[model samples]
Target: MTGLIETNETEAEAARKAEADAAARKRVADARKDADELAARIKVDGPRIVGELLSLARECAKQSLIAKALNAELPEGETPVPQADIVARDFGAEPRKDIRSRDVELWVVADDGRIVGDQAAVTSSDGITGHLHVAGAGLRWRCARRKFREVEFNPRTFTDWPGSFHELIRLPRLDGPGALFDGSLLTIEAAAALDVAASVKPTKRQPRPVQIELIPVDPTWPPATAAAPTEADANS
Candidate 1:
């Protein structure tokens, strides 16, 4: 009967609509899941982001006349000898060495509403979440100076994996007082934290795996210049 046929067609159309709705919901859920994994990866390797800031500062100092002037003013980390008004004899003397610093820290802020200090996660390990909450939180470093920089953690997190950056930066020094990608005499601790982050394998977790090796890039500066500034008088 015609009535029976109409009912069957209506049922078929309803089924198709249901399937399409389900697919759309699935896609949205998947996108949200991807965003979440990305956020976790960023949280783990955030330290390197701080290191990059330090590197940029070093590059700035290396290229600026102000830096050379400051270097001259500060001198090497060696002790300074007191210039005696009258010398007992015209003999030569060794200058005292200035104290050298191989340790420092800095700050890192995630942009684009990508990450927040919010959303604490409970790890599989017991109270591991609390440990992370304490250790992982805050700016990794407080400050950095000279071509010297330092990174926390016993082993290089980025080089080791499961802890590294998911973002690359081509940000200029103008972005912040200390924002560049190169520094002369950068310490290995910070180097591993920065460049190493973008080269490690993903943690590959369920639901969504953490993907790293994504970094901010500035191709303008050659690789050689990446570790330091380029100028006629780079040391200055």
Candidate 2:
């Protein structure tokens, strides 16, 4: 009877251990399943979420800059120009007749109301038209100018570009150049691009900058020589 009781106790303990082990294995499997599902969801939604966040951030920055520009004090000779006026003058049914010569200086306003590129030429064929010919040697100006050319030449490539009123109202930066306001002018193509950018609402589509690929310089005089065959290549 004592032996039988001991045998029964041992069997009960073994059963409890088996139950615990089975529960632990089930818990691990459930955890792994959850982890896999989470990874799959992230793989599908991660890019979209990141894109939306970036768009939101850009819109916020653009609005903040615009507010700063609107509240900024003007320089002695400078006057504040409305964004609508600029658009009207450039895209109106009738062309402006009171075009100014290139000799006139129209400075680009920074977000902080500081003037940049004071020497930039403001020219117009029609008296009411204005064009800011940015000639600053600075890297920022160079990039801005290059981008303008790219958009002007290839407007179709960047149909979804974001344009802000502040960018046009102020000095155009490569990363954030906005609309062209009155009193200053951009090329018609540039202005059109800005108009497209401004009119479109922010969406999941990310605006990509025009990429200009550099052509490799062709070898002059002598062409590149081929590498000599190795011993292994000769054996093959």
Candidate 3:
């Protein structure tokens, strides 16, 4: 009888332990899921918020300077008016011309972890994975995971492509120079290959998606023969 009682108690304890372990695992999984969701949100929204704030702050600073200058006399005849007055005088002197950019999308190919050229690539209509659409000023780039959070391109390192489609990009980081997001800028013609209907909206035309493939360079790759940099390199 005592043996039977002991066996029942042991089984109950084992069951309790199993339940505790399952609960612990569940909690850990939940935490990881939450963290991933937050990370995705940050990646998508972080850049846009930062850019808007920077722009807003700049506008505020200019307005404040102009307000202060308006109350002060313009310093006598070229004696160097306060910086504020100079800026304020120029603020609306000329008509503000809006700069329009044609939205272009392209796939940047990568070779051995570097962007080889600025020419964009034509993408097929299949599902896009391991690829992203990047768009920005002529050669400068701004890539977003979703919206607002833009990745800035550094011109110096990217111009070193030697025919292979590989180049390095500087992503935003709290620490200086985030890891290289390597890829190419598709040539202008690749814009025709974009999924236009998927990108358009009923109320507005969306910015074209330029898929950028971020691949880190392998420190282990063999070195190549030395050669002169091309025109693109010099221009970049």
Candidate 4:
């Protein structure tokens, strides 16, 4: 009777050990599957994730700069004043998709109440080709002509090729033009004319375009005076 009891106890111990081993093997296989799935996801989405993070950082830096400028211009004991009333509009399609094949018209205005006429500044979404035609009399037209001439008709200062990854165009500031023009209008024009092309080749997956907000900087905030350039000065 004692021998038989020992044999049964040993058999039971072996069964428990086998069950544990089988569970361990299953757990290992499941872990490996999960790891492989994660690796595949990262491989597919890594570039887009990195691009989004970079864009977020760029936007944050821009906001920080704007805040610093506002703080610096505020009076010592005065509350900060809002410069412009921002109006948000919702376009169903993404800006890149909407603006990609379209030409944009901008109404550039000056503080002196001068406006760019119907033959306004028109630019392609890509910023590669555009015409700056400001019709009307006075300092605004002259300033625009001079600036365009200086840049040889191309306002695009910097661009990342193979696609519109990033671009910078130098436009005359309100203060630079003797405060005759509104800085807000220039900002709007720049925002509208910005390039959004991601690639030259047609791909099913288009890269996300950079988003630009129309934030007007107050030309009067810092309080600097610039005399309007004379005809001779403009010509020279």
Q: Highest lDDT: which candidate?
A: 2
TM-scores for every predicted model:
0.28, 0.32, 0.33, 0.31
Best by TM-score: 3
The local distance difference test score of each candidate is: 0.44, 0.47, 0.44, 0.43
**CA-only RMSD, every prediction:** 33.7, 29.9, 37.4, 38.4
Q: On residues 40-124, what C-alpha lDDT tens digit does candidate 2 reach at each position?
A: 7655664455344434434444444454577587667766544442343343243334433333323333323233444335444
Estimate, for each residue in 66-159, the C-alpha lDDT of model 4 and write its tens digit.
6557888887898754222111111222222221233343333323323346533543355333344444643233212111211123232332
How does model 4 fare in lDDT? Answer: 0.43
Q: What total of clashing residue pairs does each candidate reach?
A: 18, 9, 22, 2
Error of 2 at 52 (Å): 1.1
What's the lDDT of the predicted structure labeled candidate 1?
A: 0.44
Per-residue lDDT of model 3, residues 54-165, tens digit only:
3333343454455556647655564433333234334323333444434443333432233324433323345231332445533433221211223344323222212312
